[model samples]
Target: MNQYLNHLHVLRLLVQRELSSRYKGTIIGILWLFLQPLIMVIVYSFVFSVIMKVRIPGMDSSYHFALYLMAAMMPFFAFQEALISASNSLFANSSLLHKSTLPAILLPLVPMLATVITETIALVIIVIAAYLLLDQVSYYLLLLPFLVLIRLCLSLALGYVLAIMSVFVQDLRQALGLILTVILFITPIFYPVDMIPTELIPVNNLNPLYHLLDAYRAIIIRAELPGIGLLYMAGFSILLLCASVYFFQKTIERAKEFI
Candidate 1:
């Protein structure tokens, strides 16, 4: 128990360092945390919900699409942001890598936890707005914590691969940016899955984010439990996590050489 508590303290410092460094300089450092996402919420909500006027079948209120968009955006943002940050975590902290005997596995976690903390705050604001405007909240809202855990594991798995690869191939950093862009457009972020043609459903099924978003939407927008299919995806994430940890440990020793 004491050991676990000590790790928690270390984790806290890591997360704090990440936030501070990212926001270094400028007049409004930490406030940007609240302001930036809030600004994104307003801008995206305006562009899509107002100008583009997108709609989903299950949504009833005029703001329903915005609410749905925000709900889905919450997890996806964390997933993408955390994965990118985790991918760069090792290289970004190269100095720290040489410092001590701390577990390298813990490095990627800093960004994940930092982003989760920031997004959780944004999510609360959005959800409260959702409840106020729509007058409804899902019992599945209770499943949010579990969904977060799944997202963390999924990002961590991917992060392990990207972080190691990045040390060897500098181009990977830029390549990852383009890849994440393609992923964003491919995933049904701004649109509904049903909008896709029937023939493409098979292609859509191949995206892991597709299933994660579906399960997330079940609770966030529909107030329904995720289908049993979530179990399969959860299992997939577990396997990926185990494989990633092993790969990271094996290749990590050589990472410093490339860096």
Candidate 2:
């Protein structure tokens, strides 16, 4: 019991350090966390809504599209950032791992926790924007914490798997960026899911991210409850997390040698 508490304390400190180091030399510091996503949201909203004139079926105006995009983007940004940072966690912390008795799992966790904190702030901004811009507030928004938990589980599971694999296959770090880009374009982020062709619906269902973002949109944009599929996805993510933890533990010793 004491050991678990000690690890939690260590994890908290590591997360603080990870977050501070990310913006240490910058002028605006942690404000970049909010600004970066906000800027992207603004740019994408303009390009798609103003120039391209994209519109959703039920949503009346371009502002609704912007709000929809913001809802999806915050979680996706957090997921992408967490995965990328956690993937490199082992390599980045190699010296600390060798010098200290800290659990290697904590390395990936540092970045995951930091990303969560950063994106939670971003989500708060989105909520306020939704309330102010759209004159909308949903009781379903309360479910966001549950969805975020599922996202964290998914990110941490993949992080553990990738961090261990990256030690053996150094090229994975470079390839991951391209892979995530492909994932972003493929997932219905900028576009609505209804725009997807009927024949491709089954294939799209295979992507876990689609379900996640769908749930986010349902709550944020439509003020509706997501379907039972979200529960199933949550269960799958938990199972995958358990498997990843087992894999990470089994390979961590060999991974350290490579590190």
Candidate 3:
């Protein structure tokens, strides 16, 4: 218990440093945390709603579409950022790792916690936007924290594994970039799920991210509880997180040698 507390203390310090350095010397500093996602939401709303003439069925306003996009994009952005940052955590902190006795797990954990802070800001913007645009936010929004917890678990599980492997495979960073792009398009963040082809529904359903974003839309847009599939995915993510920790502990010794 004392060891875990010590690790958590170390993690808190690392996360604080990571977040502070991210926007250091910038004029806006932490305001960029709120502005960054807000700008992305506005750009996406303009591109899809104005330039492309895209519209969500049964919803007349472009603002409504933006709300939908915000709900999905905020979480997806956090997941993507966490994975990419965590994947490089060891390499980026290689000098510190070599000189300190800190547990290597704390390196990847810093990014995960930092991503969560930014994500929380994005989520607050989503709530305020929904209340203003939609005229009322859902009571279901109360469940959002639980949903975010599931996403955190999923990110950490994948991140730890990727972080360790990335020490050995330099090309993984590029590969993950391309793969995340493909995933962003395929995951239905911009379009309604019904817009997907009928034949592909089963395959898309198999994607855990599809379920996660779907749950976000359900809570934010539809004012409904997430489906059973989300509950199942939550369970799976927790188990996967436990497994990834064991995997990281076992492989980190070898990974440190390479680093």
Candidate 4:
């Protein structure tokens, strides 16, 4: 517990430094963090709903299709940002790794925590706007925190593993970008799970991310509790978290030598 608290202290400082350094000389400064995602949501909403006329099955509520997708997309944005940022974090902060006596293992953790903090602030604004626009709220709203935690765990797990690997394999950083692009499409971010063919249901069920996104839509759009899939998401999160910690510790010493 003492070690964890010490790590948390280091994490907080890293997050603060990142937030400030990110926009140190910019005119808009921190506002850009909130603005960029909001703008992307608007543009994507137009292209997917207005131009392409894609439909989100099982979500028949009067809430605008854009908002429905946006709610689900926000968490995914955080997940992807944390992943990509963490992949390069060690390399980006290599100076600190070489010069500082702090736990080198914690360097990758910095980006994950930084992105989590920024995304939490953005999520609050998105949720309030969604409630006002849709004019509806459900008890299932209570599940939002659990869902966010699942995502956070998933991000940290994958981020830790990838961060260590990237130091040894430089090409992994570029490859991860391409892989994440493919993952977003197949993860049900743009469409509902039911819209997927029935035969694919069994296969899609294996994807933990599908369950997470489905759980989000269920609460916001379906107004019902997340069904069996929530359990699957929780189990998968635990499994990933454990696996990442094992991998990180096993390779952590080697990571320092490589960096």
**Best prediction by TM-score:** 2
TM-score between model 4 and native:
0.88
TM-score of every model versus the real structure: 0.91, 0.95, 0.94, 0.88
Candidate 2's C-alpha runs over 4 A off are 44-47, 50-52
- lDDT tens string, model 4, 73-132? 778878898999889888898888888767766787777777777667666666665677
lDDT score of model 2? 0.87
Which segments of model 3 are wrong by more than 4 Å?
Answer: 1-3, 46-53
TM-score of decoy 2? 0.95
**Which ranges of candidate 4 are over 4 A from the true structure?**
1-7, 41-63
User: How close to the true structure is residue 250 of candidate 4, measured as C-alpha lDDT?
Assistant: 91
The lowest-lDDT stretch of 10 consecutive residues in candidate 3 is 46-55
lDDT of each: 0.81, 0.87, 0.87, 0.79
Error of 3 at 4 (Å): 3.8
C-alpha displacement of 75 in model 1, angstroms? 1.7
lDDT by residue (1-259, candidate 2, tens digit) is: 9999999999988888888788999999978888977776678667767887677888887778887988888899899998899889998999988998888888888999887787778787777777776787899999989989999999998999999988899899999999999999899998898889999989999898999988998887788999787888899899999999999999999888888
RMSD of 4: 2.5
For model 3, residues 42-86, the per-residue Cα lDDT tens digits are 686677667876668888776778788888989999999999998
